[model samples]
Target: MAATVFAAQGASVAAVSTTVPAVKEHLGLSATATTVLIVAVALSAGAGSFAGSAAIRRSGPVAAMRGAVLTSAIALLLIGWAPEQATVTAGYLLFGLALGGIDVSANTRATAVEHHYGRSIFASFYAAWSAGGVTAALLTAGTARLGWPPAATLTAQAALVLLLALTLRAHPLPAAPPDPATATGTPPIDLGRGLWIRLAPFGVVLLVAYVVDSTVSAWSTVYLHQTLAAALSAAPLAYAAYQVGTVTGRSCADHLVRRAGPAAVIRIATLLTAAALAGMAAAPGWPYAVLAAGCVGLGVSALAPLCLASAGRLRPGAAEAVLARLNVFNYLGVITGGAASGILGSAGHFRLAYAVPSALVLVLLLTARSFAPAQGVGGGVARTSPDW
Candidate 1:
């Protein structure tokens, strides 16, 4: 159920990306205005993370996830049918909030499931997310080919998200008591300095990962259409290709971690990502850009799940609280990448957008050692035999 809802969130992200051109055309929005609109989602999502943490502390992850999925559906509906820029902006804000809440609540639940299974299973959950993104990206392309307007395309996607929300059912987990700090409404940041210090490296990796992600997912279509001269129906292919690569990479991440270790995996993936970004920056045509985007996905796929999984281990009993704090970096990356890429793209420097982040990703090599002990075998987080 956790993975399922996460997939729905991925689908929403794809829908937003695929419809960017339509949204801009329909509302006559300037590129600068569009950048603000996208950044607003990240800022609002950061605030929503705290709200999700509070919901988890009060009613548990299951309940919080249900609320988030429902909110996502509503946000989609508003965006799909809105007649003006202001209304669309409102919808975007709501979507951002829902996206943030889902990030915290779903990841919190995912780590619990990972703990129960006693191995590196977090990557598989992200694999499901990428799969959903692939499906949505294709749906967008198909809808556009059939001459569907953005409103109709988004409305159909909204219905799919709503259907996913209705299927959610809670499964019982091992009985554990709630943390007293959470019960008393204390903020997650009030936790000791040592925990934040431990989170720093993982947080940096996550920040860089999302910078790569937001750049590709949020602006690749625009880059393809404007920079590479791709047709409307074809622009979304780059995003779809990226998600397909992520699905493939994440599907194999667990086995690779078990064989080579998390630090090794991070180091190798970071190098691949940096190279792929440079390739993307230099692609001479949309086809080459699409292929480079896929490589980017393959290389960056493991970094996020590993960063998150390692951070969860820092305070197992307070996973929700800790993950919420980590989300600060996540949103910061999104805002930075989304806004900067948009501004650069607006000024017709799309290549620079990808090129700059390539160097930023190389910084992750320094943080690879932080995940050396993230696996159970290394005496990081404890493991239990598969409950199944």
Candidate 2:
């Protein structure tokens, strides 16, 4: 709920920020400035993730999450009242830091919960996140339509986040015992144990998935506007469709994992994603394009949580550290995805953006073996018995 609050608030800010010509004008910026803002946001988000991971290592997940939520609320309020572009950017940087901490802490907590429950729960947790994004987008859109001031909308979101934080007082799950073999009186993770070697292949899959996800989130609307000549009001529906697919896919991810296992599920999902990307690239009309994009969303939906689950299985005690390392690559993919889309769109080759991810999906299929079940069910800490 706290994450939802932050997402909603951020969305409100985005809606207002894009429409407020005065905000950009005050900074003497152009359309290109928006691109820079996005890059800055991604970079800040990555830094936040890095810092959040470190904090999680020091303080437990619950404390880290609380701090994250409080800090984010303050940052949102600052952004709401900022008097200059520099202040606004600083606000965003703080927001990014908060979001990063919240993200890692929450995922760590969720993973620990799943391990305790002995089932797959990451999908459901992520579904809540997707729902939060959808809710935020809708709320922002509605506020814009209602002619609410940007500051007012953002302030409303901040208030809700503050309220939500008050209810999250539970302690985090217990940390896993340190492996004497891997421990050196420091963190549990063994970088020398070919950890990245185990993580990299799956990380590549996550990179491709994030690239496609980011591209659609950041560019689908613009693509529809320029390529299909869609109405300004209708362009956002393309993104909406993608989110809907993501929500749907996440809703069903556990079932798919249980029925087919992770390796098979990932293989099928990669193929599905590739096909969806192709359809998106080849679509001749807006309807077809939206359909393809939604398919892409559906196909890639479970990749992140599943990949994180796999990473958890690889090194049970060091899941947080493993995820932190993978997150670096994941954020890099987001940055490159957005930049690649912008560059391609500028060159009148926007279709190539989709094509690039399709190729990556193929590579994912070829490297599927690296993520084969390593004695675990749903990538939880425990190993799965062959009879079961």
Candidate 3:
């Protein structure tokens, strides 16, 4: 049930991301305006993450999920039907708020489930997220192929999000004692103290991963259409392919960790992602770009869930608070990636945008050693691989 809600939010993300090009075209937004629109969502989402953490402390993940999911649907409707820049930008901000809330709550729930199982199962939740992205991206492509306007396409997606929001239900998980701070009506963890030092490594990895992610997810469609000369109906294929790659990589991530260890996996995947990004930047045609995007997804997919899992490990008892703060890096990466890519794409320098991340991603290598596998509930860290 938790994973399902998470996936639905993923669909929401894809719905917004894959339609960015259409959104720009429909409203006749200038490049700078488009960049601002993307940055607004990222900034708002960061704020929403803090709001979500507070809500989770007050109500619980289920209530937070319900509210966020509903907000996402409304945001989609507002964006799709809006006739002007002001209204559309407002909708994007609303969507960002929902996205951030869903993110913190969903990961909080997922980490609880992982602890209950006493295994490193975080990737599966992310795999579900990628699966949802694939579905929505393909849906966008299908609708575009059928000559549906962006408004109509987003409306259809809004319906789907509304359906998911309705289906969300609370389920029982392993019961744990309430946080002492929550009982006292105080903050869950002191974000200002030693927490940031412990979280810095995972946060760095997360920031880098999201930079790659937002760049591709937010701009790949536009890149294909403008730089690679793809048709409107085909522009979303790159996003779909990228999601498919993430699905594949995340599906195999846990098993790979059990076999190869997280550090080794991160090392190899980081290198692969860099190579893939370079390929994507240099692709001469949309088809090649689509294939390269998939490769980029495959390489980058495992990093995020692993980062979240590792960050949770640092403060298992306060996973929600930790994850919420960690989201600061996530949205920072989004703003950096989305705004930079949009600005560069506007200037016919899209290739440089993608290429820059290829090198920036190598910084992940410095952080790879930090991805220690989850020490299952009662089980100590896996003995097969030495802790980095």
lDDT tens string, model 2, 1-388? 3234334333433333333332444455454654555566668778878787777778766667778878877877777677877887787778767766776666666656555545665676666666655554455445546666556656766675676677675632344333311122354455556887878887898888878876777777667767777654455566766767777888898777767777887888899999999888888888888898779878888888788777765655655677777887677777788778767865677788788878777778876766655234433354332100
Q: Which stretches of model 2 miss by more than 4 angstroms?
A: 1-28, 76-84, 156-164, 171-193, 282-288, 378-388
Q: Candidate 1's residue-wise lDDT over 51-81, tens digit each?
A: 9988998887888999998998889888888
Q: Which stretches of candidate 3 lie over 4 Å from their true place?
A: 175-192, 375-388
- Looking at candidate 3, what is the lDDT of residue 234? 96
Better of 2 and 3 by TM-score: 3
* Ten-residue stretch with the least lDDT total in model 1: 175-184
Alpha-carbon shift of residue 162 in model 1 (angstroms): 1.4
Cα deviation at 233, candidate 1, in Å, is 0.6
Model 2, global lDDT: 0.66
Write the candidate numbers in order of decreasing lDDT: 1, 3, 2
List, residue by residue over 1-388, the lDDT tens digit for candidate 3.
7777877887899999999889888899898898899999999999999999888889877788789989998999999999999999899999999999999888888766666556788899899899888988999999999989989999988888787777777765634333311122445565558889888888998999999999999999999999989998899999999999999999999888878889988998899999999999999999999999999999999999988988876666677889998999999999999998999999999999999999999998998777775445324332231100
Clashing pairs in 3: none
My TM-score estimates for the predictions, one after another, are: 0.94, 0.82, 0.94
Error of 2 at 325 (Å): 0.8
